[model samples]
Structure formats: structure tokens, C-alpha cells
Target: MKPRLHSQLDVNGEAFAANREQLLAQLATVEAVGRHQQTSAETKREKYAQRGMLLPRERLSLLLDPGSPFVEIGALAGYKMYDDKDGSGAGGGCIAGIGFIEGVACMVRVDNYAIKGGTISPAGMEKALRLQTIALENKLPFVTLAQSGGANLLYANEIFAPGGRGFANQARMSAAGIPQITVVHGSATAGGAYQPALSDYVVLIKNQATMYLAGPPLLKAATGEIATDEALGGSDIHASAGTGDYVADDDAQGIAMARAIVSSLNWSSLLADIKQDIPAPSYSPEELVGVIPANTKTPFDAREVIARLVDKSEFLEFKAGFDNQTLCGHGQLYGEPVGIITNNGPITAQGANKAAQFIQLCEQSGTPLLFLHNTTGFMVGTHAEQSGIIKHGAKMIQAVANATVPKISIVMGGSYGAGNYAMCGRGFDPRFIFAWPNSRTAVMGGAQAGKVLRIVTEAKMGAASDAAMLEKLESDTAAFVDDASTALACTARLWDDGIIDPRHTRDLLGLLFHLCKHADKVTTRTNQFGVARL
Candidate 1:
């Protein structure tokens, strides 16, 4: 007689996989009918939904390409069998491996809570390491949804050490060449955030996930520090503090955003040198008269201007929420590629820092840059300083200065102070500079100057003592301070290249770029030969 075969061992192998698939399909049919139970299930599902967490199979359906091949690593990782006879299910912490995103193979991990609290088991940890390593070796991107209770709380003292697999894998992820993306879907309090930190980019769903270097329970008891997860690391903390790059409202949105971001990338090195188009500057922007607003102080969406100026609907925005003051992204000019930096016309420190990065990315990509300047100035007061504006503000200046791309500046209004310098001021070396006819430029506006003089005069001689003396001071001071105006005085010496009609902006920019393409300075540059030299 043939040797006795165990049912759990997939004794028939290939035939067993075929039988399992057929059985799963049948089970899915039953689930489609009346299998889902009681009214309380909705409440349970809602609880998970509120945390932006979804069932593993549902998440898999949302992530993978239709009918694409997927190889699951650590398929039977965490066997919670009381004995080998009880090993009916497995895969602890997560199911990870190679799958396709938009039909392109990619590295991905899906947290599975069926086996454990999504805590990394020895087998699961090996799988995660394998997937991450595979992503780097193949040069594909990595994406993982982490929702573990952490450290297999049941593992006890063995995993409790300071130097273990957790620390080792984090260092590996950091040095790996592939781009890694992660979303925090559950507790994520222990090593979860560090994993994403090791990755190139991180996305946190709002108010649902918590991230920490060391968990709160351990911290409070170990040290006297009383801190909640949000104070340690939450959406608000990460976004506002620049610790996290993207924040999504839910898991679906986070995944969608990642999909969009991944699709936009060229899957190459340094995160630059790729271009996305914007609506070309075709429609007469006189249409935007209502769009931009008469009162420059009134905020109008800069994306509208971007929409009108780029090739229809090609303005791909990045880091949109981090800095509300400026709008930055990449788009094509006519058919040629260029980067855009427009002041959202909001005065905020976050906006300034982004404006700086936009400048730098443009230079690195060898792509040209266009600035639509309508800045009032920096956010003011002690509240602003507390936001680290000064530190980021200075960094913005350096980024702008170091940018070597062919930059064109189009001043909208009030491009003043360091705002002007940061937003392609003549000092920043833009290739061509133009302002709309309605714009008023200055280092500091004339009103601010007048106010300063008034304060000084009032201090020197009381307001009661002012008559002819105040009148002379007013006339003389106004004329001298008119030096701040962005007029013939500013443009006569090539400080600006004169104003242009918005309707012709596309053609004008395209022509300028083509000219600059053949410009004497660019042809001799190393960036022209590509990043290989660097």
C-alpha cells in the first residue's frame, strides 16, 4: 500500500493547490450569499474602518493588478499549532512578496492579523527581509502596510533584546537602493514607524495610526515621561513637524495616493529627471481675471493658473499639504519639460521651505523652472518662529541659490523681502524675469517705510509738534523710499525682463527654453551629460 498522506501537508502538491483554489472559490460564493452574520458585525467592521484598517483579502483586492502573478513569501510562517497536528493556518504579522502594481512587478507586504496581531514572526520577519532585499536587488519600489501590535508580544524575553532583528533590518532598509513606501494602518507604536523611516517615503492616515521609536507603555514605566502617541508621533506631529511626508485620510486614499505617486515616478535614481505635463498656456488668462482675484491679499488657487499655463491638466503637484503658501510641481512646457514654483499667495513658513526644494529638484533634473511669484512675505510673530520657519526659511534661501536650472520668473504681486529673493528674485539668478502689468514689487513696500519714518518722527518730536516739519518729512521720505518700487528703476538695469501677456506665456516659455537649450552656458555643463558622472 502507498504511504499514508497527511491532509494538512498538501500531500498531493500541485493537485492540492488546484483543489484549494476551487474550494476557496466555493467558499467565496457562500460568503457572497448568507455567510456574513449578525448586526454586530457591522459595528465590528466600522471599528476597523475608523482606524483605516481593512481585512487582508480586501486590501489585497485593492492593491494587486488584476490577474497578475503574485508570489507570497512566508505563506505558513506563524504556525500557532499546540502540536504539529494543529497547524491548520499560518503567516504571522504579514503576507509579503512580489506582486504587480498596474501590471508592473513591485515589492509589497499586506499585514495579516489572522495568525497573530500582525506582529512579525520569525518566518514573517524573514519574508519581509527577503521582499525588501529583493526590491533593492531588482530596483523596484517597496510598499507595506504595517498594523502590528508589535514584537509578537507573546514571544516574551527572546525578542525583548535591544539589539536584534528589528534594528538590523531597519539599517538594511535605509541603505537599500529601491524606493520604499509605507502606510500606518493600526497600532504601529513600536518599530512600525522606524520601518517607514527607513523607507524613502512614508504616508500616515489621519488620526488613526500612531508611530513611536519606543512604545508609550514601555516609556512611561521606564522613564518618568508622560506622553501620548500623538505627542510622540501622529499625523499632526509628523506633517507639521516634517517628520512624515504624506498624510492620507484613510487606507484607500493612502493607497490611491501611493499609486499616483508611484505611477508618476520613472523608477530611476535620485527621485528627479522625470516630467509630468500640465495644461499648456493656451487659454487667454484674461479668463482668469475672476480666477486670480483683484485684491492680491485674497487667496486664489494657484493651481488654476498652473492649469491655464501648462499643457491641459498636466500639473502634477507634490508635497501639496506640507506648505500651503507655495504651489510646486512638474509639468511640460509646450512639449518640453519644466518645473513650476508659484506662491500659493499664502504667507507661511512651510510654503517657503517647499519653494526651496522645488528649486533644487528642478536643478538636479536638468529640467527648467518657471516661477509665478505672488508672495506677500513670511508668516510673522512668535507663533511663526515656533514653527521653525527661520531654520527652514534659511534652508530655502540656500536651495534657491544653489539651483542651476534655467529659471524664469513671472511676478504676480508683492514679491517682497526674502520672499522675492527666495522666489526667483534677480539675486537668485533666474534666466528670464517678467511681471504682470498689475504687479507691485519691492524689498519692503513703501507703506512699511512710511510707517517706520512716522514712528521715528513721533518718537523724536511729538505728534502735537508736527506741521511743516511732518509735511517735509512725508514728501522727502516718500520720494526716497519710492526706490522700493518695482518699476522702470527695477527693470531698466535688467533686474526684470519686462511684463508679458499671460495668454502667450506657453509659447514664450517654450521659445525661451528652446533658446536656453542652445544657450552657451548649458551646453558646457556636466548636468547635461546626465547624473552618471555624479
Candidate 2:
């Protein structure tokens, strides 16, 4: 056994103080956005109450087991997106997370009907797709407190194509023996009708819930047939006509039915008993707020982060002397074995090669992998090119893509260019990915992008180098690039799952690790086809 790495960090130093302050400011912005999304205006609340419906969150609370944690994913998904001028529609009209219902851990998704009738925005659709993927991968039961008004027509083109995949995923999940329960609290019209239809169990609230291919207006126009919503598609009709599994009197009753259904399924018995007596990490998680550099361009050791996350601050360094830039090692996260890959600097050829080998070793051992991204990118220079950094980086990327182990990623700081790809930023399909409030992700730094644009423009124009115009162009480009690379912007576009407070990183990773480990061990009964409405 190797001696544990000692931290030489000065927690009370000026640099640490500065970094903490900067991180707090970033965290404040994230919290403010989350608060706006959660709490609606007084008038809106009153209006929602009058409709005889429980708010999206109220339904979720009632459905979840008492005193259980709900790890909400992408809470501020569509922050300031498409007519969301006030930033109140942060979750893209959906609240999704893993939560316990009847002591069974299930994927819970609720449509925030209080906001824009729970319309699916581009980001909302993406979040839905991501949630479905998570459920499928984890073998977790899927539950939805569905009450959406279908797609936001303004972005229907973007939503229509990928939206179909959501239905397909649900169908496949059902075939794989993953139970899907949907409690339709309100309208599920047009394309949205398939959500409950595809689920294994459908709980519809009487009078309030409706599922139809076309509503009365569209029906009248299309077939000259005038009918009330009740006659066309109502909870009563669905229950009596066999379209719904259960019909309840109200929102509360519907949620109760869903809970009872989950409880009866005996879902929890499938998962192996998790070892709960795990030791806590030796370091204080609060130090995470100060570990990252105050300036985006400044460099800091990622080991400081690993020291705070892993159990007892212990990490067995793999290929320690071979490549310092790409740090790969084995460690215990909440007592479960894991392989961690993080960045100390831009990856060089040697670093990429090291990561590739490390990834294969973890896969062979069936250990889950975690990636902590804080790199400028793969090294780029004449020297790096000659050293075959490109091919080496490609090998690492290939290994990440093919590794059977559950891969989780956290973007702690700069995730630029190939670095983002190498670190499992969205494209690599990490089972879960999150970002720190201060994280920056883009192809390159704003300054570098601006300089490149300027150089290219000047070269193309030959002799038309107007200093004042060029200066304006460079600054404008830089400003836009900087804005686009922010944590808020990236999260809004679903670049990562969601932003988290730096201090919660260890706990979040632990929870996710448990879920992933459970998924890997549990087996499900599958059939040739999904349950269908025959």
C-alpha cells in the first residue's frame, strides 16, 4: 500500500480566499435561477390552485416516499430560453430526478403545468430524452406526473423529429421489462398522447386528465365531428374503454394509485443490498469552493478535487510517473471501487496514451469510471503534432467510447476543444454528467477564438487591416464567445445534466455511483415486444 497523498494547500491564503469569493458569486447566480424556476408568481399560484390541480412539485412530493432525497436533474434547463424573459421557466417545463416511491427508487418526471402549460421546448425535449436514457440504462422504474400541453409550437420543427425517439425509448424500455407508470394529471394531446399510451401502467385523473390524438377543435376541422373532451378522450373513457389501467377521482388519488402500483411491483427486491456503512472522505468538501482558480486561465491541480471526493482522501495513482497531465488512478468512492481520470493540464501524447491504457484496465476489472474535466485541451503545437498527440488523443477517445463501465463526468473548469470530448462532455454519452457553476466549456478560450478570427480576417483581406475596426471585431467576438462558454449557457443547451454547488460534488457522485453499481448488478426479465394497447 502507498502512503496517502498529503495536501500542501494553504486554505487561508489570499489565493484561496479570492477563489472562494469568485465561486460564491457564480453559485449565487445558479441559486437565483433555480429559485425563480421553483417559485411562481402569486397570481399564477392562485390561478393554478383554482384549477383543482396540485402543482407539479406537490404531486412529486406526495408520490415520493417520506424523507427520501430527490436528485433533481437539469432544474434550470431552459434558463432564459425562447420567450422565457423572466428566467422563471428554468426547468424547461419539467422536473425530473431519481426519487423513492413506496421505497422503490424510480425515475420521476413531472410536467410543470404552472409554466406555459408545460410546453416542451427544445431543451425540455432534450431533458426528457436524457431522463428516459437514464432510466433505461439504470433499469429503474419510470414514473411521470404528466400534465403537458404538448410541444411548444414555435419550436415544433426541432422537437418533432427527436421527440419521436422519446416514444421509441419508452416502448423499448417496456420490452426490456422496465415498468413505466404515467399519471396523467392534465392534457396529453397531439403527439403527447403516446407518453401514457406507451407506459406499462397508466393512471388517469378523472375530469382533469385527457389524452387524445387531436382535441375537439382539430377533430371538428379534420372530420366535421363535434365532440366534448370527455367523449373523445377522458379518464372515464380510458378506464372504461381499457386505454387506462387505473382511474382516480383527483390529483392526490392519482398519485396514490401510482405509489401503490410501484409498491406492488416488488421493484426494490431486485437490487442487491448496498453497503451503507461507508466511511466519509477525510477532507472537507467545503474546500472545493476554493480549489479552482479564480481566473479561468489560471491552472490548479485536479488532485485537490480527488483528495476531497474519494474515501479517506486515498487514491492509488496509476502510471504515476508516466504522464503528469492526464491523471488516472483507482480509488474508492463511498466504499465502492472506481477508476478516476482527471486533468492536471492539457493532455499531451503521453497523457492521452496513459488515459487510454487506464480506461482499458478499469473496463477489464468492471470498475466504474469518473472523469473530472479541468483542461485547456489536448496540447497543440509543432512539437505536440510531431509527438502524435492527435492519434494518442483519438485512442483515449475510442477507449472512453467503448468502455463498458459506467462513465460519469464533472466539468470543474475549462473544458475546451477536444478536451471536452476526451472528458466525456455530452457526446460521449456518460451515464451522467454535471458541471460546476464556474465551469466553462467551448471549443477554445474566448481570447484565443477572437485572436484566431482576427488573424484569419486580416489574412483574407490582405492589406485591409483597419486597426480600429479590427479591434472592435476582436472584442465583440470575444464577448460573444465568453458569454456562450458560461456554465449557464451550456446547461441551458443541455451540454451537461445540470450545475451543482461545488461542495455537493462528493455526495452527488456517491449517490450516482450507487445507482450505477445497482444497475450493473440487477437483471430484468425481457420479452420479444413491448406491452401494447391491443
User: Which segments of model 2 are wrong by more than 4 Å?
Assistant: 269-272
Task: State in Å the error of residue 131, model 1.
Answer: 56
The candidate scoring highest on TM-score is: 2
Count of clashing residue pairs in every prediction? 14, 0
lDDT of 2: 0.89
Candidate 2 per-residue C-alpha lDDT over 263-302 given as tens digits, one digit per residue, 9 for 90 to 100: 9886764224556777766778899999998987788888
What is the model-wide C-alpha lDDT for candidate 1?
0.60
TM-score computed on alpha carbons, candidate 2: 0.97
Model 2: residue 360 alpha-carbon error in angstroms: 1.0
Candidates in order: C-alpha RMSD to true structure: 29.5, 1.5
* lDDT of residue 496 for candidate 1: 59
Every model's TM-score: 0.43, 0.97
